[model samples]
Target: MSENKTSIRKKHMEFTPMVPETTFQYADLSIKHIDAENTLAMVRRAIRMGYDAVAINIDLGDISDYYTELDMLWTPGSQNNVDGEPPKKKKKKQQRKDELADGIAGILKKKLIPPPHYVDVSQLNTSELEKRGKVFRQFSRITFTANEQVVINKVFIHPTILSYDIVAVRPGEPSVLDTLSRKTELFDIITIDHLEEERRKWLSVSKVMDRIRNDGVFYEIAYAESLMPATRKNTLFNGRVLIRSLKSKNIIFSSGAETMLDLRSPVDVMNMSLLWGVANNEARKMISGFPKNLLLQAECRGTGNGDVCSMKLSDAEKLAGNGEEEEQDGASEEKVVVGKEEEAEKVKAPPIEVRMNHSQYQALLQATKNANDMMKKIKASKAASSS
Candidate 1:
């Protein structure tokens, strides 16, 4: 009977444990020439494929080229003014009415040019999708290609780049890579274009990987491009060099998928990592653990602290209730302290324990010794003055 049951189980689909809730897949929404609909479709597909989060990558090239005030405003119909005619100024009362009627998109289109093929996730019917048991989050990542020092400088100051959740840079040469690797505050990911032959050579350097690891930056590998027959050779070559040099240290594998057909589930992506010479445990980390870490770092970089951006109403309500209870307890305690002299007298400061590691303890001892020497000098000076 046991044998029969085992056979039945084998005949059916194999049992695979559910992917952890924290596991995420970074799908490439930045595929060149991709439209808004296609990008939104990719986001939906990622959510359906069991990914908890996706980073919509945006590439900003030659920052100087995009530095005009018009670029800043990115007004859809105002890319260039005919015969240098200035934009029309509206009456204050009328302008407010138009803005209120047109809504955010209308105002945004009037002020700034949105990124090429940028999909506004806010407009998507996410509430309906969340009902299906799949909850997903979207983040923005700006990929800067370091072609020139001037360009890099322009990108650093660019308001659009700062607005992104994650900021990444693709160094044009080895010198640029070296410069960016040490500057952790300026970059989140050192992006590599798999199709570029030059990038493979640059990525192969041991020092480059070392600096990246020390500075807490991730090495990005976009796997979706490998599926294309035209770019397959170059993609594989870059992938081999990247995996060989970095191994498992601070690597994030994302499907630079442009469309729905190119997208793969997180489990499938883990299996794909095996083909790239990644170990089983490491492969799992690429899709799950590594992405989570990258997002956490990006979150901290963006908001000054890693905070969960969204919460359920139930959770919020519970937190509110707990806060009320805490407030009540605090009030009662305060009343007791004020009303009872003995209770007020009994309230004392809690003892603080200072525990230190070897290095910290040594530093503390050195500080004490320095203070003692300074005190001795002061006492000697006092004695001399009295004499």
Candidate 2:
């Protein structure tokens, strides 16, 4: 029991919580699929806990019908404009027909609800609107995939900057838009795992962060705890490099947490910030102030009144040396072994043929006989052909 206690203590000392700068909250906007009351409760909890911001994910499955209905409803009035006109009983039957169509239109319009803050584009389905407008906002924001291509061609390429993920960029390759036009810029908030793979393939996180910092692109980095286990080495290394190299003012720490269950309490994230060298006030600003400001942009205020401790400097310095040496050494050794010798060994091995399961010596004998038989058959065929 005493020995077990000592072992447990040692393990505890070695354990470092894999917490990062940001946590992201993912929210589904499906009114029917999601329990509204439960969702509100979770949102309230997140608000109380001080989570940075919530990412509202609107998938195509959620709003396909809405968009289709909207398209159908707007098809009739594609060119019609209702000017103020008095009611005439002579046109009562025509008016009744118009009234019924209008009633149906109203219902369809109500049903074609877009995601919050999203502007609907299905209504402005005119060639004139398309030509005159630089970009039109899609009414059904939930149809992300179907509308993404449309957005890129009609919206992103326009003078306006659209805030959707560009699906075209592949690993180790420059963005299609990047190669095509200097004026067009691609921005995305990739997972730490994806970023790590990209970093490994081309540039380090510091290099990427530096480029973004210099380029002045508006972007956010969200920390995913679920991805942490799979991306342990890259997460720690990249995060350390990023925090060290990038200006704190440029970096936005977010909860990349997907659901309410996935979220850690704001206090927990605050504690994580402390671990990551953030002062309490600075941590509060990153978690609450920065995200609200960026998401709300002009409307949100920047002042964050939170307790900040002066001991953060000494505390960070003290914790700086924790497990770094072990991680670096382990990563280096693994990379060296994986890169060189493994492929060479595969090429050097000779191909062997065997008919059936047998003893090792029997299998060898069978393989030898098979090879000799094939050689003899080849010689016989050659002789026959010559003759």
Candidate 3:
């Protein structure tokens, strides 16, 4: 098997093989056929692709369908159980003994089975992932095919939807697009999931672009779609038009891969951006800075307030050192102040003297002379009147 591009880089770079912190992978982990083991494998492949972070996306629209299927499986007299009754006691005891024997056999075989699909990220301890400095963020995205004016309210208030780290909206119709173009706190991303023509037509209006920009919402281009032969042409064309419309201001590039094969490296993504009309600098940011800012904004929303500090370990360490220094300096200053208070009996301030410059003195003299001259004129008038 060929070594991963990341491992190749490590060989050349001669180091512990660190992926750039800006590299992120946004992929679908909730697909119908993707089990937990498959999802973990996809994440591992992403890590090999040099992604420092991965966002597991759950589509809000698809979740209901999934649960609905699950419900159908539990129907009365379903194949899953015999009328929902407990297994026979004799069979249960025999099955338990057989399972114990199978468990011993499994241990001897060194076979490890993954947890059930129902186990979400919250249920797992991520200390090992943290040790690798790898982060997994959960995002919920909903694509609106029409004006879901009625359902929009329910979607926003849904507890599971609100718990997601990020909420992205993809409007499929003009009415929905226009509604999304306005300021609303319900979404962080205005993803461009339409065809080439539709993307161009919708983004042609400057007002819509301006509103999206004003709202600080990001535009997303899912690269995995571009990798698929069927959707490649549409993806490329739509991406080019989207970059032209947004001018790479608030754009993010996500893998959107349902499987590991669809994943690409961050550098490859930037190179792909060049084909989409995004400049090299902006392209780099699409995979890095832009997505990072979007995640930060999403975090602020999830926390219900934007006023918070998310410091890196290095930054926290530096601040801790500075705080200690400040404490020492403050203690010394306090001691000095106390000593000064004890040593000094009484302190008095010298009186402040007021002085006029030559120009000011001359002006004052002129004013005094004018007053005396006026007074003398009044006295002379009075004497003349008396005479």
Candidate 4:
């Protein structure tokens, strides 16, 4: 029965994404990474449409819905320690506390059978994309709709939340935008939602520009919203205001696409930017250059002291870039030593060997005794002064 289950899961995991030849440059930071066949199809469509990099977005608002359905030991107080059961080790006790703090107790408890934190794109074949110079890549991102400052604050440093490649938010008010700006290391992109016009009213000239300047965070305007008949006006208004305020500098044009139908080519998105009050030169960067900067900055966030660590693949690559790159496999070490050192320095120093007569040996011993006495006297004097 166990063997059958394993085989069944492997079969389900097996998938081949559509691999049309493509090149890199453009990025779409918001790709819905849900557990559906259509999500894979959406990624396939993205590649075919010329997107080189994409991020799988997980919305905090819909977490409960996704978690409950996945069903991996999620219950009230599941992360809490049992009253009478003693924690065998301090490490185990601390682990439980972390689980509660991060609200990932269900995932922590299961060990090997942990709940999914991000979409698995390991099965994706990118050989064709790589061959074409695109090097297709996928990243995980978490979206938070900032309604309650307290709620967003509590989860801001959550291990699972910070683990994503990007952390984006859609602020509902001016105060929330102010709060989001200060958290440079936690949040990456500030998404604009035209569907909720009231939520976007707080977006001001000074406020938007200040957040962009101070935090160096990017503002994402979804082109998909512009295509909708009802949302087109608000989308154009919000995007143009953002473009005009930032002077076409910090804006990123994305599809915010849920399905393949919503995804558009990079050229189409860039063309739309020109109509939104940006120059043709800056228009091209709205899709490619600005987003590439955002991705690099977001990636480096995990490589710095607050959240950066060498454990992540992308983080490891950044860490490697800072210093010397690794030598090729089977390279000669002798060549490296010769290249880096003088001929005299190449040979190791010989071990010291000394010979002394009886009288000389006695004098050396007496000198050593005098030096030990001098050190002891100095230490005693320093101790006396400290007292």
Q: Which one is best on lDDT?
A: 4
lDDT of 3 by residue, 1-387 (tens): 235423321211011213554233433322212556766666666655656555655443322221111112222222233455656854665666666677555445432211123225565455654666666543333332323544354455444445444566666556656776653566677666544445346656656766877777787888888887888888888777777776778888887777777778778878887768787767777776776667666655533332333445443333233223322322211111225447632211111231434344344434545655687799999999999
lDDT of 1 by residue, 316-335 (tens): 33323322332222321111
- Please list the C-alpha lDDT of all candidates, in the order they appear: 0.59, 0.37, 0.55, 0.63
Error of 4 at 10 (Å): 25
TM of each candidate vs. truth:
0.58, 0.36, 0.53, 0.59
Whole-model lDDT, candidate 2? 0.37
Q: How well is each residue in 1-387 modelled by candidate 2, as lDDT tens digits?
A: 667534422210011112332222322111111434444444444444533233333333322233332223333323333465445643564666687788676565643333232222242233432343322111111122221232234322221112221211212223422321222234332223234344333224445545644543323334555246775556555544545565555445554444566456656666666545666776656655554333332111122434332334333322222223322322211111224546521111111332223233244434555655687799999999999
Among all candidates shown, the one with the greatest TM-score: 4
lDDT by residue (35-129, candidate 4, tens digit) is: 65767777877877777788777655523222222233333444455567765754576776766557664444422212223334675666666
Order the candidate numbers by lDDT, best to worst: 4, 1, 3, 2
Which residue pairs clash within candidate 2? Answer: 22-254, 23-254, 23-255, 23-256, 24-255, 24-256, 24-257, 120-139, 121-139
lDDT of 4: 0.63
For each predicted model, how many residue pairs clash, with residues at least 3 apart or on different chains?
A: 5, 9, 0, 3
